[model samples]
Target: MSNKVIKEPSNQLEYIISSKQEHEYSKAVNKLFDLALTYIEDAEKGNRLGRKAAWTQGVFEAPLFYACDTVPISAIDLGRLSSRNSVQIAEEAFDLPKETCSMISVLLGEWVLRNNSSVKRVVAFNNACEPFNMAYELIREQGYDVFRVEGAIRPKLNHDGRLDQVIKFLSGELGDLAVWLTGKQLDESRMAREIARMNRILAKVRTVMELRLKNSLYIKSLPTMFILMGSGHYFGKPDEFEAVLDELIDELNSSDVIPSPLGKVIPLTWIGARGLEFGVYKAVDDCGGALLSWFTPNPYDRNWREDVPPLESMARYILDYFLVGSPVHQIKGIERMIEQSSSKGIFFYHYVGCAFGGVHVEIFRDYFKKRGIPSIGLDGCFQVGAPSGQLLTRVRAFIEMFS
Candidate 1:
């Protein structure tokens, strides 16, 4: 029997899997995902790292969303740039009072609930998200130095100057960590100048990457397979990441793949892993229904809360943009994502993994039923490929019956 909707997901798979041919499993797969854990363990050993973030030569000491998420652990030693963990790492490292920093950490804690382990230090934070911020405090109590990244989001990207400035400052200060982490030194002057440029490139490249993955060429490669892995780190050098991204672009241009479902193409919504990998076009084609998975899909996160950060930074836009008018912020993205389905049915996979998301899938199933969308959650492992074929059949059968 020939399955329909087999156009491979060349563009979207990169977000899920790191490289080409990632659908196939190899012995080294787990090694790729587990690398970040090693760093946290090494740091706990308290001997692998030097006091400073060695940033010389060509190393980029980046910030990560959390100390314990897959990015920090899977990306091991690759320059884990920590996000403010809902707040800046600097404020906590210096012993600032509980304020916004605590709130940030609360969100950070929530983000890390899936498996947080990489953060070595924390910054000052307020209690916005609650007990989550408390975890950072507990980490510091244990004698590890967790620094905070500072500033708040002004609702407008332009007003985020302070945040950007802090990023620049930290990029310089973490110079020592770069050498210690990447094992390379650089010309201080050259490194400093390149930092901003590198920063620019990251933004530019992400934009380019997003656009390219959505193009016509990627559509031809149907039913693509994605193997997921992360080094669990965020910062180091933009050049290296840019190189990986560039390589990805080149690969997508010259590859053949497949997608799922068929062109009755409905929107598919996935809430797991990071804000990458929702092969909307492919999923739409597979199910013969329209599909729309967020870059970082979460159910509870309905608006622009960083706790709600997705590939689309989808928080504000969904509430404001989608015009669905959600009362409980959680409804905007989650409901809207599935509501796009004219087929009145949806198949959701609550990934047992995390790069950037985790919201109650049960919530979706229940709520969508009320709205008449009929959302279903599929059980599976995290990051590794090859979900049960029986499960796939169930999904296909459900879609067929609906169609």
Candidate 2:
């Protein structure tokens, strides 16, 4: 995990884009990964000791990743690299249960095997779900400095001083981490700059989300998702990410009827984690449908009110992130997406071994059923290997039901 160049990613796309010559997006994604790795390398080499944050924060934003020089690596990314044997490597090394091992377990194993030396600190948040809780404990047992944070989730929707409470809790936890890691207080200027960069990234993300509905764009939703989400570890160089996004918007604006997989162009809403499967998005389009909304975790998922304090603004962003709280919030998010996109159907993605997602699928399915919206469930992890003849057939059938 040092600045020492490791083996190339087994996945061809990761390989293609990791190359400097492929595309702006390829370069941007690789740049983000490299930047995060550089920090880890620095930490490993004692250049910046104790500045690393292991994100047991689940899908919520880790402000320190960009706001400061600390390295922030998501546990989800640490587990599932495109290599077929990455999980096995984790399983053997961590003595993880073979039968019921979830992605998070495998991911912790991967991080343990690959990044144990560089990871000096671990940050866990409440309400990320059970598997994440278990993973957090495992990290602590492994002897890294661990910090637990409270997330914004109240029993009653709107209570007195809820916002204030959330802000206080958020600041307390992150602020303490900042002090512990860097021995400095939160940098207002640095946080503001990072917020500004994130705002721009989010704006582009919204545009891409909207443009996915446009049949004439002819671009796949996967790249847009990847660019917006940035391999789930860090979003490096907003300008570079924006460059690729601008190219896409230009292409979409210039085109009238670009070729696409969406046969009859029936728009659908994707309700699940992001980056689980690019193939499913393509499959939906290929089966005469358009995936207008893929509800993965977005840090800047909402409008950043200039009226609010930067720290509070960042807190609110994480509070409202799609994956932060309960399934009620997720259901509301799906309902809003459906209304906004005017989607004809919903596709619930369940990663094969993720109980959190699996449990929520039934809830989503039931909700959609009550709404009289036809929804289908698909299974996969974070790769293109999700789509199969059976899955494609199910997608086609689902689209046909609407047609």
Candidate 3:
């Protein structure tokens, strides 16, 4: 009936990460888990306080739901609880294809377990992989109200006129989504306020990223991932999340942490979606590699422009997302992260059944290969412990090559 039901496993993951070092930033990590617990508890109860709860297909849509005075919970948040079990349930009970994205399968299984869940509204975007689009439809078929925010396709030529049209189109779509959820127009001021709060959180995350790049030894890959992942939905509490970010930033800046010894740790850039298995981080760590930057979430570096109208700014933010843009743009972004982090290679960890990045693994690998930057593509799923021994072996070999 309370968070106690799911708190133990979440804390276990946190303990594993925080136990790695004696940094003060561990306090912030604790805060993040606390926030996630609160959100998960409220979501299970179908609402938070008095706010209506809505399942968000992705993190980017959380801000919009916040503006609408609704609680937005993501599948990523749910999958963090018992991903391996969820995937098994999806396969055995739901009869979902094994080829379905593991994240989607986990979501479906979670939804099934919570059949009595009072939450009925769902918000999703069309820019994601096809599996997600199909998952939304499946959720809708079960009688949950689903509202999708349409995305714009990037044009071949970049021009202000075309860009403006795309923004306008997306703005209208967002406006419609707001009205559908609230039966009233979205308040621009309220949306702007939410954007401002998130921007503050993001600014702090950027500082953490810089700190990690400078001293990768201070915070390990798993903890760094936890921090960046929180920015997606602020773990359902923007104010508290911002405070946690500030604490983390202060700890990183003031701590007397030393960089790793030269030739001891291989600095690498990860260019793919967030990994679900803890072993993935462990494999890299065990292999003497420290991920300096994660490219997928880095698109959040482009903060919402407060100078512009809230709706228009939101549109621009969605359009400028790395996945929504061309492969060339994504590659360019990856190049920048490699250069900035002085990374020795790239780890393209693509999720199985993810058409977004999984299908393009070879392109990224070939591009980096021609440029003399070693890259490896490891196919994985969202289930916990899904990282096979063979996958870890490949990771070890890759790091050994750098050595």
Candidate 4:
């Protein structure tokens, strides 16, 4: 056997550390990093304090694991932090194609290298993409206890209680997943508590998003994305995460606004997958542009219903996600975000391997162009590196148009 190992990337922590020293929300950012480090270390050790640690396929499925007493660490989040070497290891080990989604490849690479051996269980869904489903199968073949949830695709034309039926089916599936994880029936009370806790964090995130629109200089683009995405699993510490959000909110609310380092801020809305490179956001910042909002299906943008049955409510939350609807619905969502953020342009970036997002770039670009709004689509892999010359040029040109 070839002796090789995939070590967890420290670049993410490095970025967070640098940001804490330079950014406005130092206290909260530091806390967030500490919490994330604790969780990652615990996960690598095979549990969170005492609960089972499971790799979760998507953010939406995290709450189910939380309620079922499992710590749901996001596999995609891990992939986002992966270094190029780690990705290569995954591709070679799994015989993954060059066209395989980078996120899936990175996670599989980490698993195959036994970098995250403590996470012996995987909670995956079928709704994300084909490669993700394939990853689930591969994980099972690797001797993992994998639980797959059947994701419901929202009907484009809802008629005759079709939406309700989808909700019911998905709820049942989630219920089954909950029981499978814990060998006990789904606990509605615990589910409600978890949902409530997440809702609090989401509400705070919404406030920060609003603040970003009003005070675009208060935070940077990459950190905004990080904060919003953290709502997915709360870095495996809900209480600490909440406190971090509170601290960040207070800082943003009280801090005096400062002029952009590059004068004349051009507000923009990012509409696709977040590139793993920090330079992607730095390029925008260098161009005197601020990404005020992102048009994506973020759980932080909405709340789960605490008044309803927890499983059914979770199902509704999934169905109600902006991405679950038709293209028209997604377009409308983008329009609302642009209007709210007063964005002068749209930055649509997608990984070359993300077929689902890549195909829609032109559709959205054309739709927004007709309305006289400028937009640009960039395609690249989610690898940790500096932005390409062409990428920087396009970003500079796009922002210069507004300038």
Candidate 5:
């Protein structure tokens, strides 16, 4: 055998959409990225906006395209910048929260700040809320221009009207320049595929640990050292995603099985609206945690279950959902995982200052605690920058406590 295991294809000339159980996604992010990739070749050939982003690189490329007189519309979703100048600049410019929005943005922010050299005017949107807005404030202050995209109504299933408005607003805001849409797509197929790839990758990683656990490499921990690239969007692309998934299989086959007694095994569930930050996921894993799955959608999220919009319907949905043993929201999943896993405690990384997440974290923590499940909450800008030693230190402590 040629030791060459082919995966899903990455050969589409334009953008590609892959499904997990294999459904088609043609909305919002999928459409936007498809549109962008349609122009990758032209961009790389050097358009007026300068180099259009080529698809052959790792994740999102820096020094992004900027046509003359047109500052591209971009979205940032991880990490943060810590500098006196940058911090002060953000405070003076907007009616923003200096204290709350400290130093955390998405992965794209850091990439743009470091790469796009000729970007004279830059605008960024912060739908992620709280610390994201705060982080934007700092980015604005630091000589890097950013605009905050206030959270509009988050749409539920059959709410194409809201998604339409979101897309329209983004397209409008993008203006005449080539728009850069970064982050997760709310496509069920794509999400499922991502979850599937994650499942496969984690299975490989867990295999080694399983061998150590049972002396037979039988049951594994799930994906541990997964490298789905491009802000973890590779998981969204059926082909490139499968590339990384296939890659993980090889890595698992060649590496040493982690011998146990593995102290404090952590099986986690992560949920972010667009998606969770991969950087935080990696750092958590580095500190000895197994991400069960980053479930961006709550069970009530139009994906796993139907989302009831109005309070009457929502309340009814909740009452009925739990009654049927299908926990309605994200909390239900956490509760279910703790009930199912071998983990000792739950760690909640509340996106440093995400408002919705802050509220959700508290809610989830409370729900789990009532069941006697221990959960730890941490503060930081997840992917916009390198996770400081402070984070690792905290994780170490958590793991030790697990032991």
Candidate 6:
């Protein structure tokens, strides 16, 4: 990573998008770190434009920060800045249980010694799972203002009133948070504009995803996905982020980009959490395999209804996503991705200590087998690295059986 001082962007969205440059993500990650560090400094000087709001996980909307004049950040995004050695050492130093997620342990361990004096608040959705909820309590005890969002009950997209109710519920919570943080009411108009821009970004992401599936552009596309997932919470300005997405979409759609020729290698669909462990999937791609689909909360799933309220739009987006609600809802999403990408096998990269994903791995593995889709369940930490040596051997053997 570069030691360059990260400058606050004249245009925040442009700056954020620039920090997540594809093919040079290490530099981007460095820039993001510097950005966070800068924010901390500003907060200390009482010169900050917005209060800091961090999601416990990656599920929350980033636009909420803009509406409330808060800096959006996530531990998951910052996880990219953590070295495997650092996380491993932190885990050992903390003496975390063997069953704990190293990624969470790393954050907890590091936070203990670090000065996060700039952070004033933390927000988490309840649906993130049990382990994360426990982690949130620890974060609260560290003196940050912590708030919990009782996330929507698994509501179907087709259910008319359910989504409306969910939106109303979250909107109330967000409105309260904005007022409490900034001493101003939530600017519905600003949120509407931001949500509109988010919708555009979502469209571009969907386009990239479709192109990726059509051409097996997984290797080229994951960085862009990461950008979308991280940029919103990284103090991203909306208009610039949209422009960046447009450029990314153009690059992905270019004729020079050739599809992967992994002929017999079974392309896998990643379920559960996507860790910051870089190059894991690319290693598989290099070994005659390809990643067909990498799932995350789908922002584009919302109905871009002009008449609908922005809060409702965000609610619809959150509720309609593949990761929301029940195990059955997620299973449907997984099966759809598998079919859409023409994947021959499923890789349940179950994060250790994630109860939800761990339990689903067995169910989905059996379900995939029953449906004639070969499945492999691999266990590792959230910041876990690429499959190598023995793990790589197992992945290759799994591929060989079907190939």
Question: Per-residue lDDT tens digits of candidate 6, residues 97-170?
Answer: 76777667767654554535445466767766666677678767767567787776656564777666777887
Residues 313-399, candidate 1, lDDT per residue (tens digit)?
A: 221222232111222335555555444322356555543332111244555556677876665565543222233456656666665
Candidate lDDT scores, in order, read 0.35, 0.59, 0.73, 0.75, 0.38, 0.58
Residue 161 of model 3: what lDDT?
A: 85
- Which lDDT tens digits does candidate 3 get at residues 120-164? 777878887778888788777777788888887767666868977
| Model 3 ranges off by over 4 Å | 1-25, 46-49, 92-94, 158-160, 258-263
Best by lDDT: 4
What is every candidate's alpha-carbon RMSD to the true fold?
Answer: 12.4, 6.2, 4.7, 5.7, 12.8, 7.0
> Against the true structure, what is each candidate's TM-score?
0.41, 0.78, 0.89, 0.91, 0.47, 0.77
Pick the winner on lDDT between candidates 1 and 3.
3
- Predicted structure with the largest TM-score when compared to the true one: 4
**Backbone-clash count (model 6):** 1
Q: 230-333 in candidate 5: lDDT tens per residue?
A: 22233223344344444434444554554334554455544333222234444454455665533332222222122322212222222232112222344655
TM-score of 4: 0.91
Clashes found in each candidate (C-alpha, N, C closer than 3 A): 128, 4, 0, 1, 27, 1
Per-residue lDDT for 1-403 in model 2, tens only?
1234434333434433333232232333344435433433443454334334444433435445556665455555443343556566656756777644446645665557655455646777765666777777776777767777666664346578776787777867777766766778878677777666656666876776676566423544444445545523343333454676666566555556655333356778777766444445555544667677667655334665456666677666667766555667667767777888898888887777777777777878997899899888877654323445686677778888877
Error of 1 at 301 (Å): 16
**Which stretches of model 4 miss by more than 4 angstroms?**
1-14, 46-49
**Model 1 ranges with Cα > 4 A deviation:** 1-119, 123-128, 147-237, 256-267, 271-292, 297-403
